[model samples]
Target: MKIRVLGSGHSGGTPMIGEGWGNADPKNPKNYRTRPSIVVENDKTRILVDTSPDLRVQLLAANIEHIDAVLYTHGHADHLNGIDDLRSVNRAMNEWIPAYTDAKTWSDIVNRFNYVLEPLKNDTNVFYKPCLKRNDITVGQQFEIGDFCIGVMDQDHGFMRTLGYRINQFAYSTDVVELPEESFKTLNGIDTWMVGALWEEPHITHAHVDKVINWAERVEPNRLILTHLSHRIDYETVSKRLPEFAELAYDGMILEL
Candidate 1:
């Protein structure tokens, strides 16, 4: 399996519109983040996780022309707002894509992009708007998406709950403040874990450095790649602070498992 970090920044991304890079160095390109998202692919399938607001740029940079499916972690704007960009993918494939998420996230997407969910009118072309087939998922359930046998668990995201997905030996868990015990069980024996660590300091809705390190110790993945970083966390500084087996994720980072 191959995992690509399409975007690694926090909700607002590094160097927020008005505010600029807080502690991250401007000279380091890795500090210039977009938003949180990833692509997991193998010989037979390519799955996108979260359609970040920077979806267009990220996909273009990654040169991804096709996607087998989309898995939504939650409904936060940073995660789901760029959903409209799926129209571009639809144009390329000339087919509606399948999207998997929990019931609440489906509701959120439906409420925000009802038009996209609507069947294409006879006069409308597939390229004119995003077309998606929704598949509702439940926590603790296991299902298959192409070549992947995925297991999902519930994560506490402060104001809401997010889904954490484990595909084979790799797992992606972002926008999480706390992981339920069952979630940890789902993550057990993973070889590589891509999880969120917002910054060095404690956060109300996201995981901090200490919390992430603690979880890493428990999960004991051979490789721990942290994502969803804020400008407050400097890549060089945090990289030095992490264990040898753990490191901060950057946009375009790829891992093969």
Candidate 2:
């Protein structure tokens, strides 16, 4: 399996508009970051996790033409607001894309994008169709999405409750502030892990460096990558701080398992 780091910037994105804090050194080329999103692909499927407001630009940057499904972790705007970008692909594919999310997330998406469920009208009604079929998921359940076997982990971010997904040998947990002991128990034996490490300091709705490191101590995957980065974690600094087996993910980074 191949995992692509579609984006790694925080909520507002790195070099956030009107805020001059991304790559300060114009001469240094490694400080750029985009909104947080990841793409996982195997021979038979291509699944996207969390479509941020930057989805269009991110997809274009990756040169991807189509997607097999969308898996949502939570309902935050930065994680889900770019949902409308699916329209183009849907028009071409001519099928409702499968969407896997929790019940609350499904409700929120339907409520936020009512046009998706509102019936089509006759004559000259100006309307749009959202190409999504939301399927509610449960914690601790095992399932499959195309060729990948999936395991769900219920997590809490203080701000909201979300799920972490373990597919094949790789497990992904983003937008997580704090994970309960049980969640970590479920993720104990993954070969590779892609998780969030917001910044160096504690945050109300995201994990700080110290927190994730402590959690990492528990799961102890063979390889752990820290993503969902923020302006505070410059590449050079965070890279030096991480363990040799772990890495700091940047936009365009890809991992093969």
| Highest-scoring model, lDDT | 1
User: So what's the TM-score on candidate 1?
Assistant: 0.98
Query: Which digits, one per residue and each the tens of the lDDT, describe model 2 over residues 1-257?
Result: 99999888788777767765654333434457777889999988999998888898888888876889888888888888988887766766666678898888888887797665554567423325656776778888888999999888888878679889998889999989878877887787889988888888898988987788778778888888888887777788778878877888888888999
In candidate 2, which residue pairs get closer than 3 Å at backbone N, Cα or C atoms, i.e. clash? none
- Predicted structure with the largest TM-score when compared to the true one: 1
RMSD in angstroms between candidate 1 and the native structure over all alpha carbons: 0.9
Off by over 4 Å in 1: 123-125
Q: What 10-residue stretch in candidate 2 is worst by lDDT?
A: 22-31
How many angstroms is residue 122 displaced in model 2 relative to the true structure, after the best TM-score fit? 5.2
Q: Which stretches of candidate 2 lie over 4 Å from their true place?
A: 22-29, 118-128
lDDT of 1 by residue, 47-73 (tens): 999999999999999999899999999
